[model samples]
Target: MKTILNALAEPNRLQIVELLRDGPLTVGDITDKLRMNQPQVSKHLRVLNQSGVVEVQPIANRRYYKLRPEPFKELDTWVDSYKHLWNERFDRLEDYLHKVKRKEVDDE
Candidate 1:
């Protein structure tokens, strides 16, 4: 998971992942869409592939890049584990706000 996060931490790699979210694309396609040179796009793709965030398929001489679902599913599960903590914090904040509002009304 750290590796996946590190890979996605790079802005260019994150953009590549966003592009792949729509569908698989070749290096050329990404380069064109991002207005970046081929070598730069390829480098980002390599990092994404090494981190298991994306997979490459060689079809006829072109490499197609697409997202790997497993990493994202793992990330989702990790985030979901913290949901209850966030909910509790939000509930406490709500209760405090209500108490403050009531105090203000009484003072008025």
Candidate 2:
């Protein structure tokens, strides 16, 4: 969880992480997607690499990045646990509204 939290700490890093959701991208591809320079992209990638949120592989002359997914899987599981709480609350509210509507019709 340390790596997951740290990886998501920065806005640029988060943007870069989200962009890599589809698949691996070269440095140039990620930079072009973000409208940033190569150096800036590398900086974010470095942080992600250190955090172990992403993996980098050198192919030919260029470096490519891919999402590690493990860290994000931890995050997803954490967030998913609270899903039912919101749904239950919304369901209650909907039932209450329908009851109120029926009461109004009866009074009319």
Candidate 3:
């Protein structure tokens, strides 16, 4: 998970992941879409692949890159663990707001 996060932390790698979200693409396709040179795109792709965020499939001479679902699913599960904490805080905030509104009405 740390590796995955580190890979995605890079802006260029994140963009590559976003591009792959639509579908698999070759290095050339990513380079053209991002207006980056082939070497730069390839460097980002290598990091993504090493971090297990993306997988490469060699079709003849060209390699197609696509996102792997496992890392994302793991990340989702980790983030979901904090959902209850967020909801509890929001609920308390709502209660406080209501009290403030009531106090304002009484003062008026």
Candidate 4:
């Protein structure tokens, strides 16, 4: 989705998502791990949450953030649609390179 892509477009938010991949983390933990201030980390987390890339679980006082799989799975599916195109192009390129190498060897 556009919203999910836009949310991941920001470097900080992308990094936050990568961090969440390992497991759930509190805002403070994210801030400390990223070496960023609380407000900045919180803002990135808010964007990720809004885009449905991450979900939060509130345990009494602290909120822990974790990846919600679906958005990323959707992204993977979209990318897969173009996977064969890349493979075809790479195969063509490889064939051309092999021909060039054979020609050079013959010349030598």
List residue ranges in candidate 4 displaced over 4 A: none
C-alpha lDDT (0 to 100) for residue 18 of candidate 2? 87
Q: Compared with the true structure, what per-residue lDDT tens digits does model 1 show for residues 1-108? A: 899999999999999999999999999999999999999999999999999999999999999999999999999999999999999999999999999999999999
Tell me which residue pairs clash in candidate 1: none
Prediction 1 TM-score vs. true: 0.96
Once fitted onto the true fold, the runs of candidate 2 whose alpha carbons sit more than 4 angstroms away are: 1-11
Per-model RMSD to reference: 0.8, 2.5, 0.8, 1.6
In model 2, residue pairs whose N, Cα or C atoms come closer than 3 Å (at least 3 residues apart or on different chains), thus clashing, are none
Best lDDT goes to which candidate? Answer: 1
Alpha-carbon deviation at 65 in model 3, angstroms: 0.4
**TM-score, each model?**
0.96, 0.76, 0.96, 0.87
Worst 10 residues of 4 by lDDT: 13-22
Q: What is the C-alpha lDDT of each candidate?
A: 0.96, 0.90, 0.95, 0.95
| Superposed model 1: Cα runs more than 4 Å off | none
- Per-structure clash totals for the candidates: 0, 0, 0, 0
**Order of models, best lDDT first:** 1, 3, 4, 2
Residues 26-101 of candidate 4 have per-residue lDDT tens digits of 9999999999999999988888998999999999999999999999999999999999999999999999999999
Of the two candidates 3 and 4, the one with more favorable TM-score, higher being better, is 3
Candidate 3 local lDDT, 1-108, one digit each (tens): 899899999999999999999999999999999999999999999999998999999999999999999999999998999999999999999999999999999999
Better-scoring candidate (TM-score), 1 or 4: 1
